[model samples]
Structure formats: structure tokens, C-alpha cells
Target: MSTPHVVVVMGVAGTGKTTIGPLLAARLGVPYAEGDDFHPPANIAKMSAGTPLDDSDRWPWLDAIGGWAHGRAGLGGVVSSSALKRSYRDRLRAAAPDVVFVHLSGDRALIEDRMAHRQGHFMPTALLDSQFATLQPLEADEAGVAVGVDGTPEEIAERAVEALAALPEPAL
Candidate 1:
């Protein structure tokens, strides 16, 4: 459990990865990248049209993101993504063993609320349920912590920082 140099705030859509990632990055004093920005045009279009992406649609994008992760977090960087499946996390881990996932767990109501209230996002509110259905909560076997979203964004970010701080430092 080395302190994660490259940390990913991961979960299904509306789990606050975008909102909390930057805060976590600030806490860790590392630069951050939003996983959505890495999505290829087709994936973005599908999601914008309220279609949930399948594995085939995701693999290439995931690979590209992994390559980016390899370079930035090879040294260490913070990233935010809806890393909903074990395979997705594996792609990231393949890039860097030091990569750690921060799983944000919240109930459907709260997540839907966030998605509905979210503004200026390509992902549509209609896709929320599908995202939840597709989400495979990170297993304990995965190397990281599962954080409960039971408080303010500040509280969650601070809790994540504290947990990360307690882990052993990266081997780098």
C-alpha cells in the first residue's frame, strides 16, 4: 500500500469524480486529468445521445488513457474517471503498478440527483441508470479504498487525502 502517486477517483457517472478529483489533486499537490476528456468522439456522441458504452467502445479509449497514465503517473499524477469495471481498472494498472483507485460509493438517488443537476456536460441524465447498471464496484482485491459519499465534497476529499497519506509512499 504505497502512497499512490497516480490516483484515480473512480466510480459510475455522477459519483463526483470530476468535482472531487481536482480537490484531491490539490490536496496531493499533483496535476490532474479528467478521464472524460480522453473519450474519443464516437464515445462522446453515444453518451451524449444517452447511450451507455459497451466494452468494445471503451477499450481503445481506455488504452489511450492508460498510455497517458503511464507517462504522467509514471512519475505520478491524479486522474478522474468512471472506472466502473475491473477490466477498466486493470487497463490503468497495466500502465502503472503504483496507480491507486479511489472508489466513490453512493446510492442511486443521490447520484441521479447530481446528474440531473449537473450542467454543461455531454453525458445525459438519461444515461445515469445505465451507468449504474454497468458499474461493477471495485472489489476489495483491487488495490485502493472505497470511500462513502456521506458528507460535503470537502469532507470526502479530506478523507481521501488522509487515507492516501496513511498509505506507504510510492516506490519511485
Candidate 2:
């Protein structure tokens, strides 16, 4: 079988990273990972208590996820990460140089509505503003695509797959 693309489905809280990640992985015939699962308990607690995590708290978590991405680099998989800042993405890229990102973007109102309706998530709605403030959209040189979250998860995943396919293959 051909190696699958290792994709990081990224965005702020409630942009549907968790929801869309599995769909994208399944559509691409790859394994799926939830980035939140890599978080340290302390970090989860902080977010659950409606506090935004500091850089120190996030670095280890990002490194863990990046390490996971490194493990799956050639094997292919889909994982979700907030990846709210350029520096965070760079850290992940450092671990998995070939990884691609799929940024889920949408209007603030829509994201807030989703977060409000979300259940069983550690991230609280009160931290949504902080998340947006920290989010830095993918730059032009980045190996990724920004898919708007205006459609069903399936539609969004479809668009992601198409976008990934359209990208030129990495030079050896």
C-alpha cells in the first residue's frame, strides 16, 4: 500500500478538529489520533477550569504530539492539535518535517455556537477568545491547506483530501 499523508487537523477550540479528524483519517485510510489525548493532566485541568494554558504548559504537549507525528511520518495518520501559533506549528514540524496541516477555519459566531453545544470536552467556552487571539493562520510557505468549516464533516474531509492530493509531492 502507498504511504498515507500524515496530517495535523488544526484550529482553535470547537473548530471541529476532533470531529473532522476521524473523518479525514477514515477517508484517507489512515490511523487517527486525538491530540488532546497527549495533553498532561495538569494542562487538561487548567483548560477544564476555564484557564488558558501558558506557553510552558503547552510546549511539552506540543512536543508529545509532534513526537507522535514523527512516529507516523511515512506511515500516514490524522491527528488533531490546536496549533494556535506559528511557533507551535514550527515545533511540530521540527519533529515531523513532512507532516501536512489541515486548518479548520470559520466565523467566530459559528465556532462559539459549536463550543457551546459541545459535550464532554475539557476546553471550556470561556477560553474561546483566548484561543482565537493565539491562533495564527497557516502561512503561504507552509505545506497545508485551510478548509472552511461551513459544511458537514464529510464535506470538509473531502475537501481536505482533495487539497492534500493537489499538493506536489515532496522532493527526495
Candidate 3:
């Protein structure tokens, strides 16, 4: 049997990457990894202090997540990442070339409102602007789909699955 594709549930913070990732993984019958868990303590500390991470602060974190994705390459998995920049996504793709993304797209107002209501997340609502500024939506050459984050987690997951299923199978 052929191996399944690993899906990267990506978006800016407060887009429900954490909520939808597990559901998407369940739908795909794959394990789920929380990208934030891979961050170094320093990175977490910086964010918790309301400081935005620069590229230097993110490289190691991205590499850690990439390593996990690399390990699950053939096994299939769902991982969450606020893969805001194209360069960040490129780093992930370098580790697992076949990994596809499910970008959770939504309006700034909606995301900020959700962020404000969330509790205990290290990423502050203040960083939402930076995230939006950094985001580079998937390009035509990228193998992924964008799903609206305007509904319940279950509904969004279903839409993600449908969109992913509709993608043309990647060339081996």
C-alpha cells in the first residue's frame, strides 16, 4: 500500500490551528503533533513576554518541527504551525517534501477576537498584527489548500479534508 501524505495545518495564531489539527488528523487517521511543543524554552519565554520572534529565534523551532515531520514522512501525520512566512513553509518542505499544508484563512477581526478570548496561549493577541504582516499565502506551485475559518472546528476540519482530497496527487 502507498504511504499517506503528511498534512501541515498552518495559519496565523488564533485561526484555530490547535483545534482543527487534531480533528483533521482523526479524519485522515494520522497522528497529530502540536508545533508549539517543538519550540525552545527561550522562544516561548520571548513570546510569553509579548515579544515577537525574529527569524533567528524561529530557525531552531522550525527545524525541530521539520525533524518531526521528516520522521513522519511516510507514516503520515498532522502538525500545526503558524507557518506565517513563505520561507518558514519552505523550511518545512525541505524536511518533508511531500508534506501538504491546510492554511486556515480568516479575517483579522475574527482572529483577534478569538485570540482575546483564548486563555493560556503564549502567543499574545498583540502579535496578531505581526503574523498577518508575515503571512504569505500558498502560491500556485505549492501543494496545499486554503480553508475558511468562519465555522466550528468540526466544520472547518471537514472543509479541509474535502479540499485536501480534491488536490491532484503529487508526482512521486
Candidate 4:
């Protein structure tokens, strides 16, 4: 694609979206945005307390991230979001029509281990099951690819880049 593609690093909690997002953005020479930074304090508090966010708590937050993706459309950027539901991805696509998702997927055991070792994140290991349950993998018609999180952050980002390269260009 001649225009820059908005690449959203999406997955369940603890899948390393934040870790790999900036790397992928750097590799593609685009701006980077952190999805967590866009969350409202209430959402953070809820997640920190081990409560899974309901759709009511998420719509506004998702809109904010979608707005960011909209702002970066055509110019490219990487943003990390849990994007655990198909409807959530659809919301983002509405804002940024050309957005492409890179889903970092992994087994529950591996994800839980990663969450346990994580520090200072609002999302706790207790909420991982909810995140997984909420997640809907990219559908065949979606403009995205699912990359396994079986490697180091760098390796995963590299794999994402390769996957993106292999895909047919998103419609302009």
C-alpha cells in the first residue's frame, strides 16, 4: 500500500502488545501510541481490582483509541489495545477505515506466566481468563493477521512485520 497503514497490536491481556507495538512501529518508522494510556481512570481501577470491564465501561475507552487510530490513518502508526471482541475491532475500523490489526496470540499458560512477571500494569493475572474469553480471533474477512507469541518480544515483533509484509495490501 502506498499510504501508511494503521497497525493495531491487539490481543488478550499479557500478550505483550505494548512491548511489541513500539518495536513494530519503529521497524515501520511510524508513530507509536499506547492503548493503556487512553484508558479512563475508572477502567484502570476496575481492572486493577480484578474486575473485568463490561461493555458499558469499554465503549468510551475504545472510542478514544479509535479516535487516535483515525488521526493516524494514511500516515501510519502502531497502537496497542486488548481489542478482545470482534465488535471492539469493528468500532476501531469504523474510526480508521484502513486500520490493520496484528494479533499477538498465545496459550493461556504462557500468557499467565507473562502476566505474573509483569510489573505496574493495571491488568492483573486474575482478569486474564476474562480477557481470553472475550477475545475473538480475526475473521477471514478482517484486515489482519494473528501472530503467535511463542518467541521473545523482538522475535514476535519481527514475525509481525514479516506477516504484515506477506498480506495483500489493505484497500485504500
How many steric overlaps are in each model, in order? 1, 0, 0, 0
lDDT of 3 by residue, 1-172 (tens): 1458888999999999999999999998999999999999999999999899999999998898899999997889999998888899999999889889999999999999999999989999989888888999999888899999998999999999889888877631
Where is model 2 poorest over a 10-residue stretch in terms of lDDT?
163-172
Predicted candidate 2 versus true structure: per-residue lDDT over 53-124, tens digit per residue: 999999999999999999997789999999989999999999998888999999999999999998888888
lDDT of each: 0.81, 0.90, 0.91, 0.90
TM-score of 4: 0.97
Arrange candidates by lDDT, highest first: which order?
Answer: 3, 2, 4, 1
Candidate 1 structure quality by residue, lDDT tens digits, 75-172: 67788888888988888889766678888889888888988898999988788877887788877666677787878999999988877666545422
Q: Deviation in angstroms for 47 in model 1?
A: 0.5
Off by over 4 Å in 2: 1-3
What are the runs in model 4 whose C-alpha is more than 4 Å off? none
In model 1, which regions exceed 4 Å deviation?
Answer: 1-4, 168-172
Q: What is the Cα root-mean-square deviation between model 2 and the actual structure?
A: 1.7
Which residue pairs does candidate 3 place in steric collision? none
lDDT of 4 by residue, 73-116 (tens): 76899999988899999999998888999999999999999999
RMSD of 4: 1.1
Better of 1 and 2 by lDDT: 2
